[model samples]
Target chain A: MERKSIAIDMDEVLADTIKALIEEVNARTDLGIKEALLDGNKIRHFMPEHEGVLDEVLREPGFFKNLEVIQDAQEVVEKLSEHYDIYIATAAMDVPTSFHEKYEWLRTHFPFLDSQQFVFCGRKNIVKADYLIDDNPRQLERFTGKSLMYTAAHNIHNEDFERVNNWKEVEKYFLGNEEI
Target chain B: MERKSIAIDMDEVLADTIKALIEEVNARTDLGIKEALLDGNKIRHFMPEHEGVLDEVLREPGFFKNLEVIQDAQEVVEKLSEHYDIYIATAAMDVPTSFHEKYEWLRTHFPFLDSQQFVFCGRKNIVKADYLIDDNPRQLERFTGKSLMYTAAHNIHNEDFERVNNWKEVEKYFLGNEEI
Candidate 1:
């Protein structure tokens, strides 16, 4: 039988994109938006007062290239790679400019994965795998396989899918051992 | 029931990539390679003494951005979109630098497709669709859905899958109408 595969999202699940957004927005506009301020919605929802500020920052050339690798993401995913084929699927079509930078960032941080294991797309559901670990529920729309929701500030309230708060939990969920 | 979806490849299938490569290689290296010179072989296969010429050309930043669109591709795919959801899946992972350029090329040529319909990956089989239309047999490896091998100079000898010579033929294979 073919080994089961896992498709992991890039933004919040593996990369600390929200933290980078929060930092960049605060630097540009003095929005002073904290992790708590994000609450149950995305940074966009809080930007009604500062219209397009988030987009403006996100559009900067090197934004995604500088995002911090989420804690334990590289190590846990490396461990997970031993048992399941791992594909890093990112919705890059939304930000056309982010393509090359996102790829370079992955190469720098997750060097263990074959370059072939990377997938950049818009509709996450189109990625066929045994399991999908994503922070966005909408990205999982109509996916036939199991969906695991990676905890993000904006996605904390979403209860429709199985939730794993961090990479430690992800390790335990897949490998039954969080000690790694 | 959801409408059946078709995932089409970007390179030789929809974009006149090999033709562009031949033109560029001939201009730069004075190889004078022509359509007939490429008889059932890729431009790279003929470059025994000129190794890395193809790689250097492909690595150029604007190479993918300036490719010509295959004849009748846009109109036929537009008609096919009416019956099946359409996704343009490209193996951009092989050429990390080609990612953004390929996306912009599609946007400029196939304006009817939404940004979300684009998928860039290394393994084409990861894309879930009712049908995958591609020029490379390796890209169709292990696919569960029906596969159509779009004809290219190098892939002409390949008969592992159903073949369609051009966009008009592709229309007939899927839509049963080549009139467009």
Candidate 2:
């Protein structure tokens, strides 16, 4: 039998990038924007005047390396790996420095997923898998497989794909007694 | 009907990396090693005394961007794209700088293959495809799909998989009237 596969996004889905960015912005700049104010994919989108803040923060050496892992992402992905081929596909091309840092982050946090299970690319459409779990609907738009939108502050308004607010919801959606 | 896919390697298979490395080495250093002497995957393997030469040349900007296209690679890959999903999967994580350079190289040379068709990754095992065409037998060792060895100077002696000397042979093997 063919083993099923799942392509997972790293940024907002597995790693709390927005949360880290918000914390950095609040601490570094005069802008006191809270988490609730961040309602778009990019932190810059919410604050057009402070657009450079996002780029400045991301350009830091350890910005991507120090991101906190999303709640329940490690456990849920570990469980999913038992039955499916789990691949971590991240759009790391935009920031060239993040390539090795992201690779090290995955190795340090999720040791179960070896170098072979990671994909660092520009776009998600190049990926071929049975399912994709991502925060951005734009990434899932052209996916030929089942697209599951992991809820995020920016994507809360988008209602195009099946929604999973958290990792527990992901488990219930895929491994639930009900048919998938 | 499900469309068949083929994952192709970029370095020695589609791009003449070894040739470029040799040219750069001879032009910059006193080492006069020819292409025939390059028996291993890395240029450093052949020149153990001048081991740093490989790293030094690769670190130069546009090293990957300025590589020559392999003979008939563009035409053959274009032909293959008509019937199969052609993905250019390169093991580019070793050099972080090569990520964007390789991406732009593909965009400049093979315009037919969009960003969706390119995969900049570390290991080929993570890739999901019907077939994989690569020069390194080590990359093809654990692949579940049909593996075709593309002939290269370093991998010529390795006979673990079925070999194709050039793109013409690949065309004959895949879409020719005669059996592969």
Candidate 3:
């Protein structure tokens, strides 16, 4: 089958953004919690319960600079590239100084994320993509094609998007094989 | 002056979202320049340079859980309410669970924020407001009535929404110093 193009949102889907956010906050605040005690399932939206913990991290001199890539994002993206033209689309707006760092992170994580394929856009609605993988509920309306919503711990209100609980389901849906 | 309605976005204008985000990332990995050293002047979009830092911070848990509020947001919002109806129009989809805390934060910061006139919405573009104060670039197009762009470090793109930068300008353009 000829490869079709797919636009993927970077924050939560390709990157374990929420997880990283939580860790940084904990580290900054010097909070103590077992690693297993926190997971994707725990943090949803901006929970007040987590505010004290987060504030501790933010108070540190430079807490928001370092973030980690989602596990297996590179492998998943590479495999998907074999069957689809991939475009990285993020709503993270203009902060020109950070563009290179953001782009390089994508390349490092996805390995195949090249300049040609990546697009930092303000409006996801304007982009033309056959498929989109996103964690945002709003992005679902923007897609006319198959839009896969990566399942997250706190995506309760975003159940409207077609849910793919894990990489295996994503593989099955896009590649026609579920045993990922 | 008769009080009318108002809506606002939180990150840049109300709080130091970008600064905090940058700080959080740098602290975790020691990747790029320390958060304080970053000169965000020419940058339009958050790119690869910052991505390296972002990748590091994201590895930590609970980063986003601790986003800080804008400095003068409470005071400004209170003062604005003295002359207009105040509503919070945020693009943040995670407001439901976090609304109370956010609202309480606002109240703690400014008592006037509690007076029965605020709305927490996921889709600000679709919502109706007599006046809108936001930092997001695309939101300028979505607003119908008097739209004001809150000026801040990360919101340099908001220069595009120059018609209304502060309440003084908003009054000059929208209210016209005339009693409603």
Q: Against the true structure, whose TM-score is highest?
A: 1
TM-scores of all predicted structures: 0.96, 0.71, 0.43
Off by over 4 Å in 1: A178-180, B178-180
Candidate 1 lDDT over A1-180, as tens digits, reads 678999999999899899888888888787688987677888888768888887788789999999999999999999999999999999988888899899999999999999889989888768999999999999876566899999888988888999999999999999999365
Comparing 1 with 3 on TM-score, the higher-scoring candidate is: 1
Real interface contacts reproduced by model 3, as a fraction: 0.00
By lDDT, highest first, what's the ranking? 1, 2, 3
TM-score of 2: 0.71
RMSD of each: 1.5, 5.5, 13.5
Per-prediction fnat: 0.97, 0.40, 0.00
lDDT of 3 by residue, B1-180 (tens): 645666676656665556656667546544544433333342224445565555445334444345575554554455566677666555433322333344445445555554233333333443345667776656766565566666554454444665455545545454465532
- Model 2 residue runs over 4 Å out of place are A1-7, A17-86, A92-117, A122-132, A136-149, A154-164, A167-180, B39-42, B177-180
Whole-model Cα lDDT of every candidate shown, in order: 0.88, 0.83, 0.57
After TM-score superposition, the amount by which residue A161's alpha carbon in candidate 1 deviates from its true location, in angstroms, is: 0.4
lDDT of 1 at A162: 91
CA displacement after TM-score superposition, residue B93 of candidate 3 (Å) = 29
Arranged by DockQ, best first: 1, 2, 3
Residue-wise lDDT of candidate 3 within A1-180, one digit each (tens)?
756878888777776656666666556554554434444344423455566664454344332235566666676778888878787776543232334445556656666655556654444543456788887666667555677888765564465777887766777788787465
Local error of candidate 1 at residue A68 (angstroms): 0.7
TM-score of 1: 0.96
Task: For residues A1-180, write the lDDT of model 2, one tens digit per residue.
Answer: 878889999999999998898998888778887777666555676667777778888889999999999998998899889888899998876776677678889988899986767788656756778899998888899666899999888888898999998998888776772433
Instruction: Report the poorest 10 consecutive residues by lDDT, candidate 2 chain B.
Output: B37-46
